[model samples]
Target chain A: MSDSPVQRLFAEPGLEWRSVSPKLTIERRLPLLGLLLFGLALLAFGRFVAEQSEAAGADLTGALFSGLAAAALVGAVVGWFFVVPRVVSAWRYAEREQDLLVSRGRLVRRLTVIPYGRMQVIEVSANPVSARLGIATVTLVTASASTDARIPGVPVDVAQELRDRLAAKGEALTAGL
Target chain B: MSATDAAPAAATQASASASTLRRLHPLTPFFRSWQLVGALAASGFGVFRDDLDKLKWIWRALHGDVEVSLLMRAVGVLLLVALALVFVSWLSWRVTGFAIITDASPSGTLLYHRGLIVRQRSQVRLNRVQSVDVNQPFLPRLCGLAAVRLDMAAGEGASVNLAYLRRQDAWALRAEILRHTAVARSRPTAATDSTEGAGGELIAEISTARMVQANLLDGVVAWVVLVVWVVALVVGGVVFGWRGLVTVAPGIVPVTVGIAVQLRRQVASMMRDANFRLRRTPTGIQTSSGLTSTINRTIDLDRIQGVRLEEPYLWRRLGWARVGVDIAGASDQSHHGASLMPVADRRDAVALIAEVTGARLDEAAVVPAGAQARWLDPWVARHLGVELLDRGAVTRWGRWRRTQFFVPYARVQSVSARQGPVQRRLGLATVYLDMPSGVQRWQAQHRDMAEAAALVGELAGQARLHRAPLRRLEPTLGTGDR
Candidate 1:
């Protein structure tokens, strides 16, 4: 079937809205993983002290080391199930023709919109992983930092195109003003 | 005199003749009077501990427990002496000279310089100044000095601190900046609006008790501390039995109580410091606070990029919401960061939103029509495969009040959805709507992904519509798709 005018126009734009890179997802979740590690460490320390007092033959130092390893495994599993998703949600963004939207939170979602005409600056950010993955983030800034909109996970080429187009549009808007 | 007209002429005077820099207080070098001597001493001592441990063998040799190692003993003594000298020198330097060079400008467009062997100078402009934070640590206070911190938006650090200001200069400087920012924002046109004001009569006086009550009611830090203490007590009992609990309980109880008391006082002072005056300016609404030092922030409604209303569960009970504005040309922390409207009742938040955005949120509480039609396809296409709860399961929109809304895309200023690995695997998405505050905002999340996107688009359209009047008219036809 031939593509409709609307669909064709949006096909290129829709590529702009695809999910963020999986690596970006992992990088953002490191903090949550750190927290999980801390919790597991605490759990292991408790378990080790208890085991040391209870066991007669086992060396206390050896038991403590084993407890830490066990705790880390449990923490990774629990964190993967519970915390990783929350972190991922907080670092997500979306793009559209008229504006850019950025949001975070699984339960309480906060979306910030930056109108194309209202954009004061557009920042194209890409880490080494994102660069390798061919994805970059387009951060659309309005007068307010809180209102800055980010569209993450766009193809590097698409992000560059969006930046050029938006910059042109922003210049026109400022010129009119 | 209008504050702008009174801006100090100090910038024009640039004579290298020491007279300009000399007038600055001698103690300006200590701008960061943050326990420099103590910090250095602690760090030096920390390094010395490892060296001391290595020198233990030398001590044994010196005592003839091992063959007398004269070389090792000599090196250890010399190292200790050098460390001790560095510590004393640092302490002496910390107590010595520091100075603040100020221009007549209220923003203190001056240079703050200090240090004997290493001289450092920082130039601050009035317009570059964002916020000034005045902090007094125990030592500086005991020494009758107030640390003046200037938070510049463009600066890389937390703030530029003038180690010790004669307290009087700090107050004058703060007042000067407040007056300057206010006047700078208020041109003749705004000044006229402020004085002729239909809005100035309605003053919101937040009773000190109300401020205190709100903070105490919403605070969970005290409870957390109490829980930690109880847990520690239980752990102590489990580990050392009765004897451990007895020894730890006394120390823990007093310390916890002391912390709680300190927290309460800090909260109370924080509340006491909370003061805001909203007035009509040529640009938009002017919000000034008496936090630590006075701060004046003028938000141009035309320039306001977005608005956010965040109310944590605890704050819901206190009948309060925090309002943040994305303002251009403001500091990263307050303007770009977060400008919190500390403890405002719902009506006040609504009024402030209306006044700031020039959008009446209270007038039309319901969402505009057309959710089922036009934008539905794009909405569904946007949210397809994302996991979403059926709208039936989603609860209250606003934290305190259970005001549900049926927002459409035309009213939405922005819409975005996010997913994690699990959500991605489940093909689920969580979407959010950025709407003008008040009844137009939903108290809860939309169960349908398509519906959320449509609502976001709806608000975005309205925001664009609002900007139509402000857009300048040009003779040239700007870039268009046609």
Candidate 2:
């Protein structure tokens, strides 16, 4: 790192950056488990078809089907064991005095900031799987198409509170209009 | 017989009587209904011609001779359709009318009412009027008429339009409205009557010679023609060998010429503003331009959320740049109305920038990023730098197309510091400033991590101070003034 005094002067200004709940990791992994089951089912179906084809003396078709199914199964295993954990760990958000910042993505990281005054709507949503996992997602709708920000894997109660706070703040800020 | 005694009596008499409602020009319905007339005529002719052919065929089968009755029926049908079209146009002309009502209250609310079936009555307080536009389409221009569009700060149904007025009438009405708005805002109007002074003091203008040079420098036609010709040659050679080249060779010339012509036309349309002028007024800046349909728009000073100074690759060597602003009420994504200066020299560009944004242009020193900063953005590192001013911040970045962004402390909606995995390893971070909605993306990527952190804190504090609502003192009224 460059030790220029200019750089050192601006380092770490004592602001807390908040991470999401730890239980979000388990909630994210649950989808991968379902994906693994689907892949295995697909492999079983392909093998059954291959066995029938072989009995009918179509050896080439049987080999082709078996090879394709094996590749899919391998892809599913690697994705579940490798990609999910890293992506979930990268997800983080923090609420500042006037805006909310959400940053995610491991390789092509993107950071989106949405100001409280610009927000037109705040929504809290939960699907069956996420509801069972006790997690929800909060979405912010702004006038600009590009500034929409969403926070996923938030605890259910926290999502509601966040939505209420954001809506109230947005109202207070735009009251000047 | 005193003048003051007669003025109060006349004011009361006018207010007691109903305001007059004005109708558009008699030719307005003809202009508005021409599209419908043309569509009906075409469809009517097509259907009648087909039916005539079928009737002739039937006549031949039954009587062993084609009949003239079929042609007569077709003519009758065409005439009936034309009559229906004229009737609809008459109804539309009769129903559409607009009125400007001056309310009795001191605030002077202007009520604009217009429509055919569902009436739309919009009340605009004089102080809320931001700008006015006078547009003349090709057909309307032929008849020396124009439409006036009023832009206000209110939400849905805020825009009030008065269409199909004489061009001179439109200008007079615009001036009258502006005069009332100025008075409402407590601004003096002694010099506002002068035509040249209406646009305020001149800041810049695009010369004809400079325009031609800029067009050539843009190279839009060259790039398009080259891409088309190269693609044709490569595809022909790869797919069909020597024979393919021979076959496609004849089409290459026409295709290249067609692309060049289309691109040239597009460039001309974009540069149609013959005398592009920018001026500064007391309340804001006004820009007027266009060769045929002149557009004069005024942007209030406080409405400008952000400004972007761009030096594209072609113009960089010539020291030319363009400036655009994000205005509060402008909802159009094309940003045609947001152009501050289409093209100018670096010196003038910087001067205009300083005029719009209170921050100084040359205060920021260029701080180069370390070589390792290339991991995040390869093209951005060489030119990336940020200057934090007392009241705002300016960030410069990009290689081929350099950009300098200015965001005032009060306008900045949010600030974020980002450190990706690669950036974390390199001890660098990217900082972004979220301006109010409608402004494009503004960010400084690949900066030293420490500096990025310091920027966030400093910007946040400054923003809070500037964002605090200023208490306005009420104007004290004198007993004798009223």
RMSD values, in order shown = 14.0, 8.2
Per-candidate TM equals 0.49, 0.75
> B191-307, model 1: which lDDT tens digit per residue?
243331242333454555666666665555675776787787788788889787676667767897887796777665564346655555544555545544444444445445445
Clash counts for the predictions, in order: 37, 0
Model 2 chain B is weakest, by summed lDDT over 10 consecutive residues, at B471-480
lDDT of model number 1: 0.49
Q: Across residues B93-148, which tens digit of lDDT does each residue of candidate 2 receive? A: 66665544444324344555556577654555555666676777668888889887
Interface RMSD of candidate 1, in Å, is 7.8
Candidate 2 structure, TM-score to reference = 0.75
C-alpha positional error of residue B349 in candidate 2 after TM-score superposition, expressed in Å:
2.4
Best by TM-score: 2
